[model samples]
Target: MAVTPGEETLGSRYRSLRDLVLEELRDQIIERRLAPGERLVERDLAEVLDVSRIVVREAIQQLAAEGMVTVLPRRGAQVAALDPDSALHLFEVRIGLESMAATAAAERRTDVDLARLDRLIVEAQEATRAGDRKRATHLNMEFHEAVVDAAGNPLLGSIFRSLSGRALQLFRIGQDVDAHGLHHEHVELVAVLRAGDAERAGAMMAEHIAGSREGTIERVRQLVAEAEAREARG
Candidate 1:
């Protein structure tokens, strides 16, 4: 049973043009087609995306609200700068939310949840083995979202959804991580989750997320400076 992710496109059956444009812009940023700190010129984007400037503006505003885009004093909109304070805050919320979600998932998860977790891990591990950190990272985030879904709380799911894009950006900044270690930890988490040990699941999730904190701020500082330098050279 193959899942068709469906034909999602600007010209396809999205609810609105804004929604399509928003996703297109987001994908570009995440894929580095739109680099960090790069200005998002509305007219250029509109022309490239073959949409109206108003649609691009609306999409940019939504991204601003999501913290994926920032409006500078002199600049209109750019991909959000890699700020250390914001990264730390993101981890704080992620650790707390994911810890709680894992705990609840351990207690409430259905067999379906277990199946989904297993599948995500398999795909993620395969991606890791293939040296496709980008795909692995995407799957890893999906793994977290699956845990939140298994938590059986709609509000938690929504909050996690809102934070995921920002989280993905940070993960991209740190994707040069130990792929094998990540796969091993994910394997362990699934085992604990399957065993329904709420306390263990919560602790493991916190520790796993916190693993990224060591030197991450410094790395982000280096990466941001490098990106700024690149922009300057252009």
Candidate 2:
């Protein structure tokens, strides 16, 4: 059968549905609702998400491509086990990217950019003080996004956005550690940005990202230990 122009085909609709399912599943994985090494059954996820098994299968394939899930021929799929070495590499990339962004922003940021950053800081502070870890984490991303935007480099922004999903997963893993402490760090970064010191701002950004890397690595180790302990008991 020939499809008419401007009409959405079944394939397109299914692809769209699959993307939604993929996003939801990624959220669960990042939020630890689907913990590391946990099995992912297509039927079970399909039932829970109220979607078809086909969509779940497609979504799982996408997740596997993103390095978030592992699919075995006989074992089906499971959330990828935590790899501290890979996490360290990603954090290193982030440090380089964010530091460059901060440096560029210091040189290029306008009054409006500074104002927006100030507002974000205040809102993030409120979220932290109110004990809203989720909102605070979101605001933290927004704050870095604003910095990158201020840099006014489309290519830099594109690269940062590409790495953000895994970065966000790390954020969610460490969300409970110290919202207030992180907010204060943001305050420091803002001050450097406000001073328009390119070198200092870049250094601050690198140091800030480096600070979080250890915590995330520790969390990964803890998860692995817990899993191992469970296996030993079993």
Candidate 3:
């Protein structure tokens, strides 16, 4: 039997709602509203978000696949804790991937792409100046994503997006180190891209990513040490 238009519309609406919920939940996690190791209760979340449990379940499943959440048998879902080893591994891959993206973007970017990149840089700078760490982090992702999108390779875009969830945690932590400096780095990278020097752009991006990884790992080590101190005191 052919599916009716009404059925398709209803399904579309449901999927849209699910996506909105998913995005909101992801933001909450990234901003630490839902902290690492925090348990998520479906009924509570569904009620709070004014959605059905099914929608919450589907959204959580997607987040899990993205490495933002961990679903354990019998224990349900919780935000994934940041692990230094995993973070290092992720950044190792990102350094290579993002350098390739920078090269492609330098070669392929159009005037429209440059305009978008400029706007995002301005927005990111404003967010940092306003001391809005969460917004700054969100804009940081947008700026990098804009660069990757300009690369014009569907497979590259897919791989970049896949790494984004885990990287969000690192970005959030790295902000405590220097949000201002990070925005400054973005500005410098934009200049390199505008100059259309693919080799320089790629090298700069690789170094930028490596620096971020080091900062995130340093923060993680401090956090672990603090936790250990509290345990020893107890």
The best candidate by TM-score is 1
Residues 181-231, candidate 3: write the lDDT tens digits: 776788888888888989999998998888777778988787667766776
C-alpha RMSD values across all candidates: 5.0, 7.0, 7.0
How does model 3 fare in lDDT? 0.82
User: What does candidate 2 score on TM?
Assistant: 0.80
Sort the predicted structures by TM-score, highest score first. 1, 3, 2
lDDT of each: 0.85, 0.82, 0.82
lDDT of 3 at 84: 80
Candidate order by lDDT, highest to lowest? 1, 2, 3
> Local error of candidate 2 at 42, Å?
3.5
**Model with the higher TM-score, candidate 1 or 2:** 1
lDDT of 2 at 5: 25
lDDT string, candidate 2, 10-56, tens digits: 33445578877787778778777787778988877766666689988
lDDT of 2: 0.82
Q: Taking the tens digit of each residue's C-alpha lDDT, what string does model 1 give over 1-234?
A: 111133443645546899888877877777777777788988877766667899999999989988899998887899887778888999999999999999999999999999999999999988888988888889988999999999999999999998988888777778877777887898999899999999999999999999987567677888778877887999
Q: Show pairs that collide, candidate 3.
A: none
